[model samples]
Target chain A: MTDLTAAGRGVRRRGPRTRWGRLRERGYPYALLSPPALLVLGLIAYPVVLVVEMSLRDGRAMNISAIGQEPWSISNYVDVLTDGDTYHSLWITALYTVISTFLSLLIGLGTALLLSRDMPARRLLRTLILVPWAVPGVVASVVFLFMLDGSYGVVNWILRSVGLTEHGPQWYFDPSTALAAVIAPTVWKGFPFFTLILLAALQAIPDELYEAARVDGASAAARFRYITWPAIRGTTVLGIILTGLWTFHTFDLIYPLTGGGPDGATETWAIRIYTEAFSFFHPGSASALGILSVVLALVVVASVFPIMRKQFF
Target chain B: MNLDRRQFLHRAGLGTLAVAGAGALGACGGGDTSSDGTMTLDFPTWQGDEAGVKTWWRQAIASFQQTHPKVTIKLQQVPFATYTDTLTSRFSAGKAPDIVHLPTTTFGSFAAQGWLANLDDRLKGTDILGNWTKVQKTMMWDGHNVGLLVLGYAPVLYYNEKLLKDAGVAVPTTFPELIAAAAKLTSGGVYGYGATTTSHPGTYSEATWMVYGAGGGWSAGEKLRFTDPAVVKAMDDYRTLARYSPKGVPSEQKRTLFFDGKIAMMIEGPFVYAGLDKAAASVKSHVKLAKAPFVQQPGYPSNSIHVSTQASKKKADMAWEFIKSLTTPQTQASYAQLYGVPSPRRGAVTQAMIDKRPELGLFQSVTDSAVDATPDNKDIVTNFSEVQKLIMDACVRLQTSSTPTATVMADLQNKVNGAIK
Candidate 1:
């Protein structure tokens, strides 16, 4: 047994398998990866450090010169946390993210499943579903503005003509419906991303599994539960995670739609950060709010990712 | 040998990258002086190509260049919405233009930060300085002459003659008469009043007219008293005016609807006349302009152009000369005619201008009485823009929600007090 092991060790140390070759193999992936790693360090990691540093300083109204002159303290974070507006904005952000992400994912999953099947005009429908995604966020929001206008909007006109009521709902003016109104356009613009990801996952599932299930006299629902859901669950979780993060940071769509007005009905954390930084000219406060937002996002991903990994993987 | 080759290529690539990055950054530092020894000055204005004003600016620049051959004026135009933010960013980066168009409300904040050059000594004995109006006194901060008003206009009543006549309502000259006319004209798809009652910045200016007219103002001395009984009453009156308006419509949309004849009357400035010619013929024939119906005092919602402190002394003098050229009688007349707004000079409105557009006469009548809506108390209010937003938020709350006027006013007063503190 000792002789056999010695022979195997000698075979492993053949020509061209020298220490330099082993070293190159170990360093090649890292060498290829250094450019992207440096890019992330410069663009993402460095800005994050700056944001944390700015939060600790006393900079307001583009007055960054006060950084060293003023004492570095946690006063900004304290003020933001103690403020009533911060809680209100965070609540709004939570509601907006949860609803928008769920709606976007649901619509995406349904459309992706439908498109995965062979149907008439499937190619054309697949191409056309991405129209909203193709349009820029600001342009999409503007189009929705005209479509939902109280006086001249096509939506109100349609609802009125259908005998829904004497007058259609004042979608933006009423706080009750304003959030839903804004979310409608957001989900519309975001669903196409999910559709693309989920559709690719759906198509990757083998045909033989479904055939075997059918042979076993399994119902369509059973076949879907066993074959389809398992096949696409991992992609679905990833799509939700991404869409949730994007929705949490939704600013461009909401800013033009309501401007965080109608008495702060739709003032998300992103809008609050903008108002603090640009409108109020308090960059320190804005940076504190930004760090809080990042922490919250990480907490959400941390809690959700583990469960999702275990369930799907 | 292979390692040496890889290291050489890496260092070479990095050197090239560093050189390229430095070149790009150096390009952003701005223009160099001409080899012929002419100084180039940047003059940024927010008016852009609106209402044929670009042509007026071009002619004014050409005239200035003819007189000052050693100076070159680079006229830059930024959009009105982002003008202040852009200027502030440029100022922070030390890349501010030699001259800037400073809106009256934001001048205090910039001047307080020492961004604007004082023109006191330069304009002391000049005829241009002698033409300064009492309203322009608000532009002064810390006992220095900071800026000069280039163009100014106040809100006035604009009505469709056919809509008023068809509704059998006479022209209103009082608050009651205007409210009654709006109620009468509320039938059909058309609304009588078209005030931009939203939380838009334009609404703040529009609402200030009512606040001032009601004997309510943003401040008395250095104390900002938004809870002043007069202000609460003014907000109540404003809420009534909005009831007759299409809810949540912005100023631009209001203008479109007014041109379409869906809105019978709107409180707007002389700039509205520029688009009158483009309105439907039916709407055009019925257009009428009148002074604001209920007003004891005129609101000064004017913007001025000023020399930036970042400019060299020599460049600043050139900028001042360019600004002075814009106010010359000839340039002012062309500005009023082409831009359809009142000139800042005391007697810049000529009979020829009135003949060209009769409605401009109404704007001219109010120029002498115009008062800065939120007059700055240099000791107390450091950021006029923040104060303006607070007041605007109060106005929006009162207009859009069922919040009690007194409650909103008290909250606003506390907020303003805190901001100033």
Candidate 2:
């Protein structure tokens, strides 16, 4: 009877303590992660929430305080969604992103292939190629502006000297060529990043694979198709995704060059948002457009992922 | 000295919280006053680095400091291109400067937001009400005096006498004549005319002068007249003139071209005279000023000063005092002399000032007859930035495309109407 009473006491003592121990064990990882989780919540999640809230308000409020007093409505979203200019900007953004990304990748891939081969001053050339990427966007835009000046630009001088045409095209002033002109500088700045990434990926390919392919009567083209492409295909896809995203939001080069002018030919979604918010003092509309942009970007990514799934997975 | 994994994480989490809390506190903590009982008043202006205006402001600040030794005036230099946007951002963040200096074109938008303090009572005790020029009326918004107009001037035509003589083009006194002269002067790497042909903020002013010169304006009271025949004709004429200008050049670069004798003629404000000292000697010797070759003269308030509503009572009072010092007759006279332009104060340009600058008389006469370049409509004024954008867009369309001016203007009218509504 005394033995049974001692065993009952032991069970009673262990019950609450065992439950506490289980709780602590389950919560340990979360407790360790709370600091960084909270930081992300504060930094990234909070501003996004604020922007979403701001998008729902109605008014041309320039400040947060004034915006808070504005009436709650979805009119900003309705306005942004219904505006024809929004679609036009989206179209421009697509063209800019797609063309810029494709050109950057092509040039990057070519340069990476060249630099991969044993060549004279290969390291020096590789380092020097990053000069464009190193140049600040604003600085690059300014330099290109001077170089592309229609009347006094060195470009005009060269074109005239080479007997290309009687008069040099007004590269930035004319709408027909402004997009291409702005794209040139962007590609120049963007291609270097692709080169760096793809170059690293290329160096990882085994030389024995190429040597063995050559011995097996595989042509250079066939070798590249079977071995080189498969090896770097994953990195190229990533590079395209990243470069496309960057190009989609390009504002610095375009803003200083043309300001989406000569009839909004170069007006992308990002520039439109900026013009609406700062130039027109319509923050609500700007925020709405921003939200729509995120949605559009997600849609693009989702759609593209399925097509590229086999490579990534 | 040694903690278990959970304890270390708990302490790390606490440390992060404390660090974030400290950062938040630091960001929120801002005081103009120091422990020594000294105060600093934030003053931001695009003119902080402008040649003659910078010198005038330095002298004015020094004089004001002599009387108020405990108060420091912090002059923040923001580039003109980004000045308004920067100010808007600062005001939105509730960190508005104590003394607000705004371009007159952007003043109405700031005042409409109630970001500027009402100065009706402050103006009553001063001579500024009766003694200031007619353009001072621009400072009044919704029947309240909210700012003090400091600079007002008419646009003047600056010509190169040597270029005109070389090209055998007489000084133009009419729009058609001006175009003819500009065309004749174009050759040998020299542009016949200088204009802000690029997509820039100055495009607004450049387009305004052309439309106003032809006796058409963006609006009349609440009615927009963008589709008027006169405006279309003026824009068409402007397009023709642009062909003779350095393509895609901004106003500052256009001025540089003029100073370098690469541009034969340009229309600008009397303030452009302040830059004469920097002009090449060959160009300076041949530079001349005349009334703009247009039927009507374009003029507007250039810039103004105000006390921000965000300022504390003490800071507001100090700002008002500093502004008052700038308006005093002696200071106004000095400003007129230094700036090479007429001050807003009445009788600020004395005979001595005119004698010092023979061109001052023409500037004064032109100022007397000058029409306000900005529209008088309250709605348009309140939504000036939007209207300005629409107009600038229209101007670009006219300049770069073969689009019919009437079609462009009609489209602009619809956009402006929609914007204001």
Candidate 3:
């Protein structure tokens, strides 16, 4: 009991750590993460700041070098907000995104369910489902353009063989069908993403859960409702959010297919931004529209956050 | 030989940083200037890969290099669809090519941005001022000659002799007769007219020809005339003509249809003659060019060559020499012969050229009296791209909708007015 009370038997008391050592221990993880954080700031934040700055300048003729010297104003925002085309584009974007997302999710879920069962060439079929996604957007647009061509498309040929009608409708040029025609390729390209995600989530479900449901005398629909739906609800919501965002910002498909033609029937926000920037050479207006699009996307996310938090968080 | 994990990471990091630094330095470098005093002038053109045009360029470049041994012209090919946008991006980035070749429609925009060097001083002792075509006058921007006009021609009416003969139609010389002939030729997967009904940049030019033919125009100085009675009539006529043409086809596709023997008639520039060499065998011999069936001939400066402001003074002088070489009488004659289009210089089309391609006579006569179809008003010309969009949108509406021509034109007038302001 000689020094047990004071120094704990043969152990000496250590002095307090130095200030530099304490700070280093606290900041070591952040230092390791600083490179990626700086990259994100440079890549993402800088462009956003530049766009916001350009939106406040007069950008007629769109000389990028002269943008900094131009006088700053809110006229770009005023012009974008006051124009009727902006609202029309917003409406078109909403319709295209919602319909395309819903259809993609439905098709993806169906395909995933079909593939989850044992069948011949199941692996091959699953791999083949990704072909549409692998094909470049412009290439896919070109293919669909040929298939849905008014005068000589294979779809029209099939329709004629079945006696649907003579000289099938102008799918891309007709205002009534142009939006739907654009959405077809979009769904074909987008559904594979959901299929990949949902298939993983589907495979993770235990066989015991389905077997117990079967023994409990549940119907197939009931078993799906209790086990499959609950298991994949969170992933489905995530897929919807992601697909919605992508569809809202899609430009390559619609631009090459119609260039926002047929009297602006398929002109969405992204197309409008392009026409304003590259076509009209009005970078100020384009930047303003881009900022508004970001705001619109955030609003949509905010609206869906409550439901997502209830299920996912 | 025994590298620890930390040492390996240290070496890898240094290597990555070195590579990235080298890439950044490489990106900052512009046109090449070698130690032997040899300089490379970057020249980009949409016509660099065209069948006959590329031949002309090769010969021209070879001749220029023979004279200036230490100077090399680096010719780059850019597709016409994205040419202007590419140039604009380059100019904005302060990396403009030493030699700037642009569609005449976009010349004003580049000039307005000060990307093109003023060429009046360089032209003081040159024959370009007096001997070039009248359309070359369009090269003046804000009292400065910033470029040289390369090609100018009246739009030509191209028709398939086989289709017209099979339909028992004559080569029409008037708008009404043309429509009747088109109606006769249109049947069973074949079209009578081959207008660009899609939302294309060419749609404005196609519709503008109709407007000018109908004695209307987009603007007169600062005055907007989209709602003029003649314009309305022209737009209505265009809609009626669209019925006989294939729907939703762009200029290239329409040209393809004509080459495939599926289209009977189309109106295009004399450049279409070059494409006939690649047409289907059955259609190639049957295609012929005539004066466009319009009351007035519509023409504009097609393309031009200029020295960029971004080039050094020495390089710019070299660029000017290359451009001047292209405009020489001998080179001009060769260009007209090889390219099958009317050259900008006077007396460039020799009798031999006309004898080789009989269409040259008609091309010259029409080009001699062709009225400029582009907007002449300062504000309108400054905002031509926006005005072009409005016109294209109106054309698409007229083609795809049943709305009255008056209503569509009125909407366009309002939109164009707002755009110019």
**Residue lDDT tens for model 1, B143-257:** 7778887655667888999999999999999887888999999889899999885667777877788888777777788777577888888888887888888877778888888
Residue-level lDDT tens digits of model 1 in A165-284: 666766776666778888989999999999999999998999999999999999989998999999888888989999999999999899888877666778899988887776666778
CA-RMSD of model 1: 3.9
Question: What is the per-residue lDDT of model 3 for residues B169-241, given as tens digits with 9 covering 90 to 100?
Answer: 9999998888888888899889999999777877888898888866778778768888888888888888888
Which DockQ-derived CAPRI band holds candidate 1?
acceptable
Worst 10 residues of 1 chain A by lDDT: A59-68
lDDT of 3 by residue, A57-155 (tens): 976646666789888999999999999999999999999999999999999999999999999999999999988889888898999999998877899
lDDT of residue A290 for candidate 2: 92
Q: Give the clashing residue pairs of candidate 3, or none.
A: none
Clashes of each: 0, 0, 0
Per-residue accuracy of model 2 over A70-124 as CA lDDT, tens digit each: 8899999989888888899998888889999999999989999999989999999
Model 1, backbone clash pairs (residues 3+ apart or across chains), number: 0
**lDDT by residue for model 2 (B80-132), tens:** 87898899999988889999999998888898889889998898898888988
Q: Candidates' DockQ values?
A: 0.35, 0.60, 0.58
**Residue A297's lDDT in candidate 1:** 96
